[model samples]
Target: MDVTGLIPDFGNLAFTIVAFVVALSIIVFIHEYGHYIVGRWTGIKADVFSIGIGPVLLKRMDKHGTQWQIAAFPVGGYVKFRGDANAASAGVDEGAIAGLTPEERRATMPGAPVWARALTVAAGPVFNFVLSVIIFFGMAYYQGIATDPLTVKQMAPISGVENTLEPGDEILSIAGLPTPELAEFGAYVETLPDESPLDYTVLRDGAEVTVTTLHPYPAFVGSVTPQTAAADAGLERGDLILAVNGARTATFEDLRAFVGAGDGEPLTLTINRGGEEMDVELTPRRMDLPLPDGGFETRWLIGIGGGLIFEPATRAPSVGEAFTGGVEHVRYIITSSLSGLWHMITGAISSCNLRGPIGIAETSGAAASQGVPDFIWFIAVLSTAVGLLNLFPIPVLDGGHLVFHAYEAVVGRPPSDRAMRVLLAAGLAVVLAIMVLGITNDLFCP
Candidate 1:
């Protein structure tokens, strides 16, 4: 056996496990704390608040008589309220509540008002959403929004192209075409001719000047999506695509056209990274991309985003603007997630899109390897997904518990203990089946 060959694989596995645990632990803590705090506020006492399941590794008693603990497994967490049957809070602990007085009974989860119980169960998903919003808001505030008029902040170096644009130069026109508003620049770029060394008219030092430079939208790699062909091929930011299978690529549109034409065939990409050239072979992946007008389009993509030849100058956005952007980001994720799930269910998209624990761990490792900013962004995205998933109306989940609460509210009593047990068991089976399907896809899907 060649033991040395397995060393790199083992190291990568370890890194992925650590990254996955770290990300999952943070999200789970936030979710479980939401239940704990809200339960406390509603006069329901949480007997145990554990960040993980299985045998306890660390434990502490808080002043409120709640035992805060960390367990062996780091996969998930839960809050066990007073007089609950178990961590899932499926039913009341009849033996524990048998001797309690009226005042003490009010502290148990089952003894609380229907509204209080509902709020406590609903808080977990709500907190996950709040964490995502906070992360998005902080990122937006830190990055700042692009300034209007598309002024150049810094030029990205391209190996074989001459860049005459300078910082603070407000772009006025490109190749004799008047520049459009910043919001319309992307669509405007598509209308430009696919050629390099174009005429760039800019406002330099309060005077209009004409300079020759590479096309505004060149074959430059701005970002790479994790767990995709480009990332797997070791593509990095700022790498310029010089050619595709001996065909020259001057603009990003040319590169896109080449990839789209490939139809998932393997291509030889001539790349320029920091003045050095190399060849990379990768096959484009077929993807179902969501469109702006609430539909999806199929495309072959290598999973890299292109950008202009220079970084645009930016301005600090107002607090309200940043917060609004954060909210919109969350909303978009929620909507797109729902749409994707529906498409998968309806056979409009591939079921392979449903990723399991392994897929998420791989993505976690990839994101961490990219850098802290990318890792944080991945966490925000995963948090949104986690929040959305928990809201599904399935048993053994927060949403299922909310439904039970609703039933109790209308019937003036909770479901029978036997019926509750059966429904919860059925929900557990549905959840496990989904998990199995996801894992199967992770193992078998491309």
Candidate 2:
């Protein structure tokens, strides 16, 4: 056995470890602090508030006698309230409680009022949810709110329908249905049983024009490739390429054809944004792009991607709207996660979606490599996942503790200490099994 070879080669491994540690620490600290602060608010005394487990690497005592510590491990953390036997807050120290005065005894987890204990236990996940909402709100506020009457920006590259629509076409109705707004149009399109030829009524040249074609794709700009002519010309997501070289081009394919035919020549672009119009001058770059099937096609292009049929106008939203958006975003994440898990459990989807510490660490490193904002966004996502996981009704978790507390409330006394221990042990086993499965999937699943 080569003991010397047991140590990992540093280099990129070191960076990944650091990023993982930082991300985990932020999440763990906030979660534990939730318990600590809420416990204090409820008159519960916390003994040790630790981020991570095992041997302590750093420690400081607050004025209130709470020992806040950073431990050697960086994956998870906990809070040990006064008179608790361990970090999980599973068992109480009866002898320790007996030795203290009545007021001091009330400060321990077991001696605290049932409501206080439950509230303190619940606060951890609540805080996590709050953090997610706040982050989401900030993101929404920064991105601006999308409002609209559907206007075509770019179209799909499909051949037959390319000539039927124009980039500046304001979609008044489709398939004999009036779609006064982008959302309504999207709803109508999504409900279609199958792709069929449809009549599209659009406003162009100060008149209503009706055309028949299969609406293959949205005119929304999907992406703008960095360092490309589109980026240089200030073409952005949601910016509609209304007309190309003073000629009305309807579909995304039309925009592509015009740019391809430009052959590196400068072209005039009429752009519409939130009902405002402007002209831009850009020269297409000749470049080779890879086809999804295989090989490459050399073409003249201004780097841009188009999807989504309608260009929804955007404007700054009110604070209330931002808050509502934040809540909706969190609800969507939770609902989607639960749905995915349910599908996986029912064999409707692959269980390989489950990830372990290694997978998470690698993701953290990759996100950090992208940029600080991307990393922060990743952390927020991880925070939401972690919060959701902790709320599962498994033993040895905050949710499990609350479940026990609820039983005690109903039955007028806590479960026997021995019974508590057995349940905790079972819970530990279940949690460990899940961890093993996650890691196993990470290593072996393709």
Candidate 3:
């Protein structure tokens, strides 16, 4: 390991903080705007429209008597009804607009017609979903989707890979795993050992053929940065990271998270190049990466990108199928996200992939650097995730509120206040549990 690497420059922490705040604020605004516009349409008086939590930062009163303000906790914001003590804590008046008659209170939230109330609550999440679709279509109409072709990008002169799996052969599946796209196929290939035999089924000239071949990964035999320790383990270009310790890997991110704080000793890697899975070992070297507080912390670096090369940078999606591709891309991503969450629960997928605001901020900065097309794509992905997450059946969220509204519609009236309180409590617990799990995943995985 070269121990003489230079320090990392996050460039500036203030810039990152500002960027994160802006991104989150925009998302929140769109989400809340959806509810506000719909509520107004339903003739419900919104007494307060707040950005953030805790205390008020700034305030302005509209002609409708609604006070629009930015709050102290900037992380969350809400809309308060005429009679609401708070948005989530509606119906319980501790002194705010107390002593009003049922008619007056009805002007508030509790007295509103059931359908009106439900629609108002549903607008927040609906807005989120709309925002996602917009982002998806916009990004797609701008940058064309990535297409995975059946043709070979490279071939081995002596090993005869072209002989086994010819160019223009449409990939069907690996073993039983379906290869729907190039990204999925890439994951499958990366999961294989560098030179190990892999079963691949492809459609070529109206014929299906199964072939065995090797997948190559780049190893760091050398590094300009002293901290990339993957080089020290005798790993070099053409070596693949098939498995970590004993766990199978399918993506670059997986390999990274799985190997964080990597045992500190010589860790083994399975690499395949010319139809062979070879065992290699290496120790990581530590170097500093930029942190949030205008400082740096030492972390391990591998000094290598990966196998199955990245395509050259492109500008935008094609004029023809860009929108179609974009929509399909968003749909597929949303479905995979739900499945991924389910798998996390079942232990088939690791929860370490759950990223909080901190992680999102870091990624946002990276996407920005990549260019507008990539950044827009990132927004679409994240917006879709946030939209789905809000739809989870947990109280304190729009989805949970929708469930209550649905039940009230079925049973003829709203749930009891006590019941609502209990449900909110339960919902709060679920939120906390998810937060704890995500934080734990971050702390332990790396």
Model 3 stretches with alpha carbons more than 4 Å out: 1-12, 94-107, 144-326
Q: State every prediction's TM-score relative to the real structure.
A: 0.95, 0.66, 0.61
> Sort by lDDT, best first: what order?
1, 2, 3
- In order of TM-score, best first, we have 1, 2, 3
Best by TM-score: 1
Tell me the RMSD of model 3 versus the true structure: 11.2
Best by lDDT: 1
Residue-level lDDT of model 2, residues 1-446, one tens digit each, is: 33222123576568778888999888888888888899999999998988889999999999999998988877789999999987888787777788788888888988899999999998898888888888888887766765666666555433344577787787787776777564565456655434345688888887999988754353335566543577557676666666888977655666777887777889998877666788889888765443444333567888788765433446788999989988887777777677767766876556776778877876777567556766777787888888888899888988898899899999999999899989999999999998999877656653
Candidate-wise lDDT, in order? 0.89, 0.76, 0.63
Model 2 alpha-carbon drift over 4 Å, by segment: 1-12, 148-313
Candidate RMSDs in order: 2.5, 12.1, 11.2
lDDT of 3 by residue, 127-202 (tens): 7667766777676655444455635433433223446656456667665466655556645655554334467787
Of candidate 2, the 10-residue stretch with the lowest lDDT total is 1-10
Cα displacement (angstroms), candidate 2, residue 284, comes to: 31
